[model samples]
Target chain A: ETAVFQTPNYHVTQVGNEVSFNCKQTLGHDTMYWYKQDSKKLLKIMFSYNNKQLIVNETVPRRFSPQSSDKAHLNLRIKSVEPEDSAVYLCASSRTGTEVFFGKGTRLTVV
Target chain B: GQQVQQSPASLVLQEGENAELQCNFSSTATQLQWFYQSPGGSLVSLLSNPSGTKHTGRLTSTTVTKERRSSLHISSSQTTDSGTYLCAIAASGSWQLIFGSGTQLTVMP
Candidate 1:
């Protein structure tokens, strides 16, 4: 029973190349988030959107941004990705103050 | 700064044994959830207990908001249960969840 979904399970690109990941949730959650899990398996929130509005923005790099066309859809875009951008990007959703569900995550590798 | 710390970074247990994992946070959490990381690196939500105790299958999670800590108990360990357990806390008035370093569990058959 997969609810939250992310596209491109694995991706590889050059340092200067641009990459984008798409995510969608069927749980009808009000809040969606993007988290970066580094090689050390440390998860950190990068962006949070509530009902299509950006609510929380962490100290992520300028090349990273989140786009939401609606409450159910959230996308992550990295412009001119750097080698350090290689990590697992996970998309999640929650009904405000409740348990959060996660997607399978997209693994990005920048050479 | 909001933080989450887990004890006994790694645990190894034989099948049919039990395991206890702990999570301590720095702030008053509006929400506390536990997750299991799969071999594929995806997170699977196991339990969400803001306070008190909650149970699902053989897993139990207890959180004491006043003390700002939570504990997860696995009654019967299995080889399939081997993975990383993550604890996340959403600080008061925030939707962003700060995650702990995670506890790696290895159950041997």
Candidate 2:
């Protein structure tokens, strides 16, 4: 069983459309993060949420937003998706700097 | 921005052989963690070594914080050990982690 779950393992959509990915963790971790893995398999942090605040990576576009309804869930929304936005988005959670558990990741493709 | 660099982008090792991966950081780090990602899947935590050396099973990790370098040693490699190994470090005063591109290792039987 997966402690961290992601919905819609794969998504294919048209350009200029909106998309959202959902992630949930049962580990009871206070901090959650979103990472983007490019075609070259390079992983980069997009955003991190802990309790009351969300920290966005400087390189993230303004159209990308992270929403956390509660501690166990973090959702990523992209507006006016572009072809460059196609990648695998992974969700991870950890307590402090300890071990992190990652979801299987949702692959997004824009056409 | 802090940078994490891993050496030998890809490595091939025979079964029962020993392998070592290295990671170097650009800035002072408070936490250093290693992870393994299987082919086409999610990542799993391997070890968290901020300083000194740690051993688990056939894997051992040693981190020399002052030198800003860390190494992961795998003994008696098996085909199941073929995967990408990642190194992530949390720079001092920052809660976010910076990850290395990773070292892809293939252990052949």
Candidate 3:
């Protein structure tokens, strides 16, 4: 019973293809984030949305975009995927200045 | 340029042994959290202590905001505890969190 839900636990796509990951949180949190875990298991923040508004964009590449329909949903879109984009993308949500709950993560493999 | 450093990149412990993980941040944090990721890649929230000592079951967390450091202690470790423990912090006035590389723990039975 995860409060945060992510779709397509795993994805494999061609280098030039585009991919999107969907995330939904039922915890009613105001802040949602997208994090990327590299091959070395290093987690880095890619984007943050507060109440459906983008608040932080950590210098991510222009092809990477975050889409939020509402506060409870924050999805990640990567256009023209590259081999370097292969990694685990995790979705998390939390109240401002509080603990965060993360999804199981979507593993993307760009071949 | 905020950074989070975790010590002892990996640790192995026998069942019933204790383990301690450390985290140091480069800037003042408005929120500090400890998260556990299972081998299957599911992340679970362990503790959230910004500037004080807190405990839950066999886990204890202590954060000294003045020193920008925090620690998580797991007592009576079990094989089920084998996973990666990550420390993350959100700098004051910031909404994004910076995560440490994480400390991988293996509890052997």
Candidate 4:
């Protein structure tokens, strides 16, 4: 079974539209994270959530938000998407200071 | 600015050749991991060597926490080893994982 799963492997939306990416992990991990990979293949952290709290990457835009229902799921929502939002979004989970397991990633395109 | 930085942005090697990928971090981290992402694929954990050295299969990883740097060595490179290698770091008491710019490796058979 896939430990970490992400929905909507690919998405293409118009500008100003809203998009949400869902991520679920059954690894029984305590921490989950969202990362963005740009066209240049530069990977950067976006948000991190755990049982304790949620930490934003600081460089992330205000338009991007992360919601977690439980330790098993963390979802990313983008409001008023722009062309700059087009990139591959990856989800990962770890058992707090342990090795992380990553999902296949969702490729989003804002046109 | 990038906190975790990797060198040799891209590399190409002939089959059976050895390859080395280096990662340098700006901050002091007690934990470090090396991950590999194949073309159009997800990231997979290759090694998690924070301080000291570890080896698995044909992959060897070494990290010096005091120096805030890490290195991944691939022995007898094969076409299957061609992919992007990523380095991630996490300091003590921090759950956040900072990723470095990956090193894309291509092995020609």
Best by DockQ: 1
Q: Please identify model 4 stretches exceeding 4 Å from their true place.
A: none
Winner of 2 and 4 under DockQ: 4
Candidate 3 residue lDDT tens string, A35-63: 99999998999988886568656468999
The residue-by-residue lDDT of candidate 1 on B1-109, one tens digit each, is 9999998799999999999999999999989999999766689999989999999999999999999999999999999999999999999988789999999999999
- lDDT, candidate 2, equals 0.93
lDDT of each: 0.93, 0.93, 0.93, 0.91
Pitting candidate 2 against candidate 4, the one with the higher TM-score is 2
Model 1 chain A weakest lDDT span, ten residues long: A50-59
lDDT of 2 by residue, A29-53 (tens): 9999999999998999999899768
- How high is the lDDT of residue B53 in model 3? 99
DockQ of each two-chain model = 0.92, 0.76, 0.89, 0.80
Decreasing TM-score order of the candidates: 1, 2, 3, 4
Ranking by DockQ: 1, 3, 4, 2
TM-score of each model, paired residue for residue:
0.98, 0.97, 0.97, 0.95
RMSD of 2: 1.0
Model 1 C-alpha RMSD to native: 0.9
